[model samples]
Target: ASATERVHLGPTVTNPLTRHPAVAASGIASINRLSGGRAYFGIGSGDSAILNLGLRPAKLADLHEYMQAMRTLLAGESVDYKGRSIHVKWSNNQIPLVMSAEGPRTLAMAGGIADAVIVHSGLTKDVLADTIARIREGERAAGRPEGSAKVWAFAKCNISDNHDDAIDEIKMALAASGHHAFRHTLEGKNVPEELQEAVRVLQGEYVTSQHEQLGETRNKALSDELGLTDFLAERFAVAGTPDECLAKVRDIRDAGVDNLLILAISSQTDDLIRRFGEQVIARI
Candidate 1:
């Protein structure tokens, strides 16, 4: 209660926490003012996070409604709820709306109402291009200005001759397939025949967080548990010397990534981040 009284969070982070839209509006406004316009709200459809809390994730319909209400209130407009338009009391009408999106529908919806979309990594070149196309489509549908919404991809970086350590770092980073990079890096687009069989038996009962594997992680434990070979995991991560690491990221840039968040893979992250930033990022 003491903590709740001192801080006003901008709605629950996911759909299941559909706490009242009016309450969300008031809280976001309060925080936005306090932060002097530095506040940006990010939200996503609840998945594992919701399940962890024993709550069911949100439906698309509900997410869309929530976004619209959030936008209206942040714009300083009192919005009516349901068919009857409800108004929020003491509305500040001055906060930014950003939605966390890694999937198609959510990306489109973010364009429709939110100011930005947080794209999860495992964002392959082809995938990012497609996702961007869909987000633009939503902007067109909503009659919003082009480039009104921004998209950010989750990213990780580690550069060293001993990048094997880096790969090892990313392996443990993901547990239960709860991330973006791990999904594509390990599982890949073409499902393997063996995994396909596993897929058959598993069907909806899928195990492992394929998305949690960083593009540069090597978890021997996870690999062995999943019956994966080093060769299997190799395709997902970028290791070897600094020169090799630089080239890997150039490909990512070529694919058209905009924002890349470098998760700390080393105790010397800032120096390494700067090293990569100055050398690799500067060139590309």
Candidate 2:
């Protein structure tokens, strides 16, 4: 129904360590103009992209500064960066900025700045509620109204009659989600005390090079060996029969997720998308 809904580069890293915030803003503004204002920028603290390069995720303060710089540049204004002035003179798109967050601090920061947030926390009712609460906390801190920032749930998905196969297919993605969400810290993440050690082991053993790979990588193997596949699936995925996936989606909607960012990581990605559109999305 809206032009802005047509395209998004959801959850790309626009951190200073990865890409200069000024350049990223100019790029998005260019794309927005070219696409008739259909483009919005989505960013996050670096994950596999930075880790694979042997770098840490951007510090929260740096991320916050980058978001501020982006806001100014995209609005056709000049901003100072490291004793230099930067501006995107050709464009003034002011496209929406969406941030991806998995942890409490990141969620709060995103709520303060991002126009929307793609939450990588699990879809369980309690977890989703807590994540939203953290975002609201940030909003309140920034003097923004309640529910000012929209929320989108990031979910790994597949549709199949064989439930076991479906689960197996997305284990690697679920593993990636766990690594992304828990690698920084386990505190306040609602991680059970009993499984904390296992989670730490998974975080250490996870292979950044094979992130989200479809095959039986070491990441998937570690998830299985650590007895984490089912737990990760329950938290981060929505894979099963069409009816089952639809029910899960409805629950997510009820939990106040304003949008769904489905990550179809299976080899049959096209088929899964088509089936989800027809069977799950259509019904919902």
Total clashes for model 2 = 0
For candidate 2, the 10 contiguous residues with the lowest summed lDDT are 1-10
lDDT of 2 by residue, 1-284 (tens): 13455656423445568788777887787677667777778888888888999999988888888888888888889999767899887777768888888889999999999889989888999999999999999999999998888999989999899888888888888889899999878988988888889999988899999999988788888888888888898899999889889999999999999999898878978999999999999999
**Predicted candidate 1 versus true structure: per-residue lDDT over 247-267, tens digit per residue:** 766766676655554454556
Relative to the unseen true structure, what is the Cα RMSD of model 2?
2.1
Q: lDDT for model 1, on a 0 to 1 scale? A: 0.57
TM-score of each: 0.67, 0.95
In candidate 2, which residue ranges exceed 4 Å CA deviation?
1-14
Candidate 1's TM-score: 0.67
lDDT of 2: 0.86
List per-prediction Cα lDDT, in the order shown.
0.57, 0.86
Q: Please state the error at residue 85 of candidate 1 in Å.
A: 6.5
* Clashing residue pairs, backbone N/CA/C < 3 A, model 2: none
